[model samples]
Target: MSTIPLLASQLVVTTIFNSIESLGFSNIAGKVFSGEQAEARQEANLKVNTKKFYARGLKSLEQQDLYGAIKNFTATINLNPQFAPAYNDRGLARYKLGYKQSAIEDLTTAIELNPYRAKYYSNRGFMLTRLKDYTAAIADYNSALLLKPNLAQAYFNRGSIRLQMENSLAALADFEAAIRLDRDLAKAYFNRGVTRYKLREVQGAFEDFQKAAGLFKQQGRMDYYQDALAKLRQLCY
Candidate 1:
């Protein structure tokens, strides 16, 4: 997988974990009547096991064990079919495994299960963008931003698509918004530099490249650092 998609997958995983509190079985908590005690216990067990497998899936993903992550996430979904996060995470695993079409299908299911979650749309948008469906990808990003206006990654992703479409001015605006929301986003600075260069803003492009180079080096992204330095060299001449 390319760097952008890998970064987007990391963002998706982080977003899911951060929002985990909102993703659990909220209906599991009510008082159970005498006749329903057995059923309630089974349900509770299912929830516990589902969470256990889900956690394992996340651990596998963190360790870069893609197949293990997929297996665990599948177990999570089987235990709790309503668990949208499992499908979302499984999709990411599938994407990394090069099952792009299947990955999109899983992400679609996640969206169907929980349309209110902004990250699902954003995740799907990344997949669609990879498939070159720029229009649909843009629509997904638009939906994500509408649901969560402060989504810096969404802005950065949309800017990347815009840059690819050759809409340098609009791309510059999106990269600027992303940078405003997250100053540490090295890729946003790099893309904004590219956008500025396209627009003939030489000085602004040079500064963004320099910033991106420093950020990439600090973040231990030596390949990106080299690319940023190449941009600086191009600008100097």
Candidate 2:
């Protein structure tokens, strides 16, 4: 699969299963037990099974066992097709396994199941960028930001896509927002420097590049630090 830039560190999937106990199952035990009691029992059983499979999937993902994670997530989905988190996690696993189209489908389903989740939109946006669907990706990023204005990753990712489109001013705006939200985001500074260079803002670009190099060094990202230093040397000297 083509490697795509991650918007953030791999988003933890555990949050998806956090509300399993609340999903009420259909009561099949009608007359023998009260409807409420039957439903409660069914829900409890479903929660146990779903949690078990979800936990297994999470462990597999942690081990980098993409196939194992997919299989377990699929089992969890089969038990509860409405489970948005399962679809989100399975989508992530599918993306890792190079099933980009399938991953998008799963993420779309997850969005349909839970439109309020900013992460779902952000995840789908990242996948769309991988497919080179820049317009759709930007729209998804917009939605994510609308839902969560404080999301630094969304700003950074959107800035990256803007940079690819040669929208230097917009890209700079996004990178600035990301930096405001998280001053420690080295890549945002680096990209901002690149955007400033594109706009011929030499002094600003130089300052950003220097800041990026210092932050990358502090974060132990030697490769990024080297790249920043190279840019500084090329521009300043």
Most TM-score-accurate candidate:
2
lDDT of 1 by residue, 23-58 (tens): 763444443454498888898999899999999999
lDDT of each prediction vs. the true structure?
0.94, 0.94
What C-alpha RMSD separates each model from the true structure?
21.1, 20.1
Q: Model 2: what TM-score?
A: 0.85
Identify the runs in model 2 with alpha carbons over 4 angstroms from their true place: 1-36
In model 2, the Cα lDDT at residue 54 comes to: 96
TM-score for all models, in order of appearance: 0.82, 0.85
Model 2: lDDT of residue 92? 98
